[model samples]
Target: MLCFGFTFLYVPMVLLIVYSFNYSKIVPVWGGWSTRWYTVLFESEEVWAAITLSLKIALMNATFATMLGALAGLALVRFKSFRGRTLFGGMISAPLVMPEVITGLSLLLLFITLGQLIGWPTNRGITTITIAHITFSMAYVAVIIQSRLTGLDQSLEEAAEDLGAKPFRVLIDITLPLLAPGLLAGWLLAFTLSIDDLVIASFVSGPGANTLPMLIYSRVRLGLRPDINAMATIIIIVVAIGVCLAGWLMMRQERQRQRDMQLASGDNIKQD
Candidate 1:
């Protein structure tokens, strides 16, 4: 089942990557192996602009989403008795279950109304798209952070407080360090979501603010473009490298955590 699922999901991407090297403009029909498509991809000014715009928005969205999401997650776990906690939790999570089409349309209408009323965000473009991405990406980030916090041993925090550490210091010296992996994962997820977003970005993006995904979609609508396939291939390579790095980091952290636990247990045994 796992093999089947892996093949089902990756086979198409693998085929697209393979075709990206083909000399033929026709996607399915291969003319021969060549890197001309990649050369074309790198040479296109519009494509480069779109890529830069996408990266900028994704970075901004990831930063804002991770910050807000971490706070929300902390609140959900640490302040369960707070006023309107139920409502707040639901609102924070709404984006996860909500349909993208509805979210996009509503946000578009909202931006239009706000622009007319406040004379702010005077136009929809990179700022608008980044905001939209942050809105939804933060929800996913919150869930990840919340789960990580739930598994953490709260006594470590208590011990820090007992040792004369202020609340803010405890967070910085203890909680945040422990949650680093989760934060990294959440940031990566937010970045991926922001860059890959098409629906919400399309709704909010204005002229001269085309994202990489939007540009690719527009081209593919006419037909398969070899340059787009080459771009996709490049993206796949980068993402794969990122995934490997993240996995390695996580594994290293886990090993360190396990060693710390063993040392603590030995200390307790010695004291007993």
Candidate 2:
């Protein structure tokens, strides 16, 4: 079953990667092996522009989403009860449940109204797209941090407070450190969502701000293109590398944390 599931998931991606190297412009014909498409991809200014725009939006969206999400999660888990807590939670979660079309339409209207009123963001573009991405991605990040907080033991935090640490200090020294893995995961998830987004971004983006997804989507809709396959392969390679790097860093941190806890335990036992 495991093998079946893996095959189901990755077989198409592998085929796409293989087809990227095909010599023919006509897809599925397989005229032979060639790297011409990759050459074309590198030389295309529009493709490079799209890649830059996508990366720029993804980075900004991930950073803002992670920050807001950590705070929201802290509130949801630590505060327990507060005025307007239910309303706040509903707003935070609304994007998660809402249809992408609806979300995109609503954001489009919002930007239009804002531009008319303030005369700022006078046109829809990267700023509007980034805002839309951040709106949805923030919810995903919050959910991640909230789940991590749910499983957390709060004794360390209480002990830190008892030992003369202020609330902010406890957060910085204990809570945030413990939440690091979740935060990193949330950031990566947010980045992926922002980069992969087509619907919401399409609604909000204007001329001169084509993201990679949008560009690829447009080409895919028209017809089969081997350059598209090459683009996907490159993205897959970059994402796979990033995931492996993150996993390794997380494991290293976890091991170090466990070792420190053991050392601290031994010291306490000796003192006692």
Off by over 4 Å in 1: 1-7, 251-272
Using alpha carbons, what is the TM-score of model 1?
A: 0.90
Tell me the tens digit of each residue's lDDT in model 2 across 1-272.
Answer: 99999998999999999999999989989899999999999999999999999999999999999999889989988998999998988888888999999999999999889888998688888899998999999999999999999899988899999999999999999999999989989999999999899999999999888999999999899898999999999989988998898789879999999999999999999999
TM-score of each: 0.90, 0.89
Residue 225 lDDT in candidate 1: 85
In candidate 1, position 38 carries an lDDT of: 91
Q: Clash totals for all models, in order?
A: 0, 0
Model 2 worst lDDT window (10 residues): 115-124
Clashing pairs in 1: none
Error of 2 at 16 (Å): 1.3
Best by lDDT: 1
lDDT string for model 1 (1-272, tens) is 99999999999999989999999988889899999999999999999999999999999999999999999999999776999999999999999999999999999999999999998789889999999999999999999999999999999999999999999999999999999989999998999899889999999888889999899999999998889999999989998998898789889999999999999999999999
